[model samples]
Target: MTKRSDFLAANKGLRVARAGFVLLVLPHAAPDAGDIRRFGITVTKKIGNAVVRNRMKRRFRALVREILPEHGLAGHDHVLIGREGGVERDFALLRKELLVALDRARAGKGDPPRGAKGGRGGGKPHHGRGKGPRPAPESPQT
Candidate 1:
């Protein structure tokens, strides 16, 4: 769960959205030695400044710790992505949402593809972020 690759892999899993967060559940083809559940939380810069992000992270950590052990699906990797304005919501409300989301996930129901919405993730891939590829290094300046 600490590695970037772990998060990326979870992104390809089932996604359930709530008012305050998005839950991603990915099951391992086979569990590790202990068949334990592992989870991670991500709060992006878009959420706010460092302090705000840290606060949101703390809340997420508390919620996961309180609920996951009993309600979570075993042998899966869970990732909670904080959404904008999540910080303003009440913790109890968020906890309820998480529980509902986890139940939906346990039932193998996930929200629709986020890319289906217009003007966002879906579209042609950008060739590159730069103006364009360098022009063959100008032929080594002749």
Candidate 2:
């Protein structure tokens, strides 16, 4: 899990959404004999400035430390992505959400509900101002 490849692989795995954050779980296909569960925390700049992001990371790390040992499975990789409200969200609520999300993900119910369409362009495509070039700039007479 120390490698970037592991993180990238985990990105393609199961995703569970919570109010404060999102959890990605990927079971290792061929874990080393000594390999246990591994996890990562990611709080992007979109969440806040450096200070706020760091605080979120610290909080998430603490949450993982407390939750993973009992609830996490061996030979799996989990990555937690902090959401917008994560910085100020209640720790207890976040913990509960994490646990519930994990259970749903394991049960294969974490996926979007039926008839739920995902991604962009689900609606009519925007013409974007007729897709024409801008008018030529008028040259100022010197």
The candidate scoring highest on lDDT is 1
- For residue 2, what is the lDDT in candidate 1? 98
lDDT of every predicted structure (CA atoms)? 0.90, 0.83
Would you give me the overall lDDT of model 2? 0.83
The TM-scores of all predictions, comma-separated, are 0.80, 0.77
Candidate 1 per-residue lDDT over residues 1-142, each given as its tens digit: 7989889999999999998999999996564625678999999999999999999999999999999999988889999999997899999999999999999999999997667666546577776676775565555655
Model 2 misplacement above 4 A: 31-35, 113-142
Q: What is the lDDT of residue 16 in candidate 1?
A: 98
Q: List the residue pairs that clash in candidate 1.
A: none
lDDT of candidate 2 over 1-142, digit per residue (tens): 5687878888788888887998888888675724477899888889999999999999999999999888886678889989998888999999999999878877867665323566563676566667568889999999
Q: Tell me how far the alpha carbon of residue 135 in candidate 1 is from the true structure, in angstroms, after superposition.
A: 36
Q: How far in Å is the alpha carbon of 89 misplaced in model 2? A: 0.6
Error of 1 at 94 (Å): 0.5
